[model samples]
Target: MPRADRFLSIRRDPLSDEVLARGGDPEAHSLLQRTGFVPVARAHETYHRVPTNLAERDEARLATEAVGRLRSAGYHVDCEGDFDTDHRPVHYLPLGASVAHIAERIREATTTDEVADALTDLTAAHDGVLAAVDEVLVALADFHEGLGDTADPHIARRLRYLAEERLGVITSDLSHTRNALADRHAPHPGRSTCTEQVPSNERERSAVCACPPPPRTLPAPPPPPVAAAMRR
Candidate 1:
């Protein structure tokens, strides 16, 4: 990741007189948001602002907390004097991180069963990640049903379609893949399991493993350097 992504500033916008958080990547943005800032997306850039109508003191408090949280997460935040502090707040790993862990497991998997085990976390019938997401979407749709806004019904319908149609497709596909892999009982041909054993003919008496080094994942050789059009 870029070093710039770990730096941000929290200050009041002169024109709007609103406390705004500028710079930082998506994770940093999420941290600011959870600290009570609303996101403002524009054609050129995106930033976060303390909710409007809040008292000036409340806005400063929110900004201070955001600075502490960002610092705790290893981010550099430049803020106004009132918002700067040495206190770093404690934050727990978010629920999304657990789902991301499944992807990490799949990346390191070398056998069909290993991949299947990770997929089970997402596709399990009883309380898997996708199932919990479906439940949340349904609940949100229900909440919007009686929200009394002119657009509430439409919003609810859209949420239902996403929960049922879009998410359903992913759940179905991953479930099928998981089931097939569960039955395959095969290891990846291109990868090998490390036996952690020294060969009998080993020249090094301290050798702990005899497995060949894993191949480096080189990027596709830059698009065969595009040749310039021959002189006409």
Candidate 2:
């Protein structure tokens, strides 16, 4: 079956006259934002909207660009006629995917040192992911400092607070955890570590190693059947 994230739609809400986008995954959301849409999160779902007061023509262009970009990346977009396009812009790997790769590495790691090594990409003090985020927060704060909006200064302060308080706590905790894991020299209990050294006492001389065969993966059982009364 096709994944839910592979489809999205863009259209102007008839009553509100607001250009809105719905039914896409995080990657599609990123494409919408890059093409000048603001995300609005609700309890049930999240969607994107064109900024208020944007000229009608500009809104169409923005939505059309997002449609083209999403289609280019192989997502199916159901959009208004005005936003339909044959254009498919080239897509590149997003930077966030690199950070997500670290999580994948940790998931596949069998030893404490391997997990710690993967975390170093996030916890490194000089050029790590958290450090880059801190730099971004500070840069955003600086941008807000000169903006003439009544709330810009307050926004700047809030950004600084987040960088210093929230992100700082996360960075400190991860750094401590990384250092601890680096020192542990322990293998994960649930995972096997293959040293690739055949046992000296092995009766079979052609044995490659002493490691046990990988466990078999079993399929999940089907859900219980609904009673006729419940169906009625």
Candidate 3:
């Protein structure tokens, strides 16, 4: 069975231009640089604490806005959380189907032919996800370019950086998947005495000698915090 590669977790933040320009809030600006900026409604209470109910509603609205932003940017919205202990809502948007699902298909394959087919399917799935990420980068670039001189330089820089980072991850994942498949399909140096030599093609190889082992499950990482708001 083929193990799943670790998925990238993206944190989104919604920040206002005013907050970015504020003198004492480097944290907000730093978050914007790291996660890219989304538009969020202004908080009414600058000094005083906001009421609990109002805070929760605001967070919920932010999460919904984030989901929409991601979709518009060309990502598949898997699911989202309501609110955390900090009263912040974080959304989980996977690029495609879970790696676990692909792993399950690999594990269930009982013959060499089946395993080979599963590997092909997994490779194709990975390619599709990489393509989706590329589409998102193109869309973001188009949007940024459309803004021309009116675009905020800081926001434009952060968006470009985020897009590059995503492309790097997707490209790396594709390389890793390709290497793993190659290792799996490579011919062994020595022949086993107990069994006849299997065919060169992976599909025709002997099941006992060529079938992949059960994939090891990696522990899922902690959810990323909500960095900012996505404005509607």
Candidate 4:
């Protein structure tokens, strides 16, 4: 899908007023630039720790579709979200993936202890992220601070990607669901909503749906970018 159609954001982060006053696009190292790292971190934690727990309907679908290994290696089947009837969501951790990454990082690090430390830290950080988002967003703040400019670029990028995708799915779902709710039910009278209003008689309101919104059909998940990148 074209980047334009896939995401609604004008840009992930736009230049701030202060930066704009200074000059054109801010420099790469500029602290003034806005980034979704905070929420993204939480999202990453959520996915790595509990893949099935992704809140947005579209995200879960996309993640399942993106699992290239699951497809190529055989035993690949995606049951389109019939969880309400068929099965419950469950998270499957890609331990092999993590171990492979850790090994590669260990090769790059200076010492065996450093390698061990890095591996431990990465796993802990990953778990910390998951726990924070699902169980406690506030607690994740501390986990965020512990990270610095030194982690592998790929890991950071992946986490950020997961976070943004999740945000999109969630934001879209909520907007859609809210519109449906408002069209059918009044909120505090005169409350504004983009959802369309439906007609119903006052006496028949209990029997009839006033302000009935159209059925919500979530957009299909965009195809995974690449096989390697899409792997859990």
- Candidate 3 — which residues are off by over 4 angstroms? 1-95, 98-100, 106-127, 147-153, 186-232
What is the C-alpha lDDT profile of model 2 across 1-232, one tens digit per residue?
Answer: 6698899999999999999999988888998888899999999999999998889999999999999999998899999999999999899887988999999999999999999999999999999999999999999999999999999999999999999999999999999999999999998988776789888899998988888777999999999998777564
Model 3 residue pairs with clashes: 1-212, 1-213, 13-227, 13-228, 13-229, 14-228, 14-229, 39-231
Candidate 1 residues lying further than 4 Å off, grouped into runs, are 196-232
Residue 14 of model 4, lDDT score: 44
Q: Taking the tens digit of each residue's C-alpha lDDT, what string does model 3 give over 1-232?
A: 3112111112222542111111113332232232333423357411111123344456455444434443344333333354112322344434334754656765665444445555554445446445555667667766776575765555666666766786667666755765565557543333212344455775854455653445999999989987888899
Could you give the candidate ranking by TM-score, starting with the highest? 2, 1, 3, 4
Assess each prediction's global lDDT (C-alpha) against the native: 0.93, 0.94, 0.44, 0.36
For model 2, the superposed segments whose C-alpha errors exceed 4 Å read: 1-4, 195-197, 201-209, 212-232
lDDT by residue (1-232, candidate 4, tens digit) is: 3222121111111442111111112221121121111111243231111132345554433333333222332222332333112222343544445556755765565433444454443334346323334333333433554566555454555555555566446545544544454354333333333343345435654433455456899999999877566567
The per-residue C-alpha lDDT of model 1 at residue 36 equals 93
Task: Please tell me which model should have the higher lDDT, number 1 or number 3.
Answer: 1
For each predicted model, how many residue pairs clash, with residues at least 3 apart or on different chains?
Answer: 0, 0, 8, 3
lDDT of 1 by residue, 1-232 (tens): 6498899999998998999999999999999889999999999999999998999899999999999999999999999999999998898888789999999998889999999999999999889999999999999999999999999999999999999999999999999999999999999977667789888999997976888766899887756677789998
Candidate 1 at 119: error in angstroms? 0.6
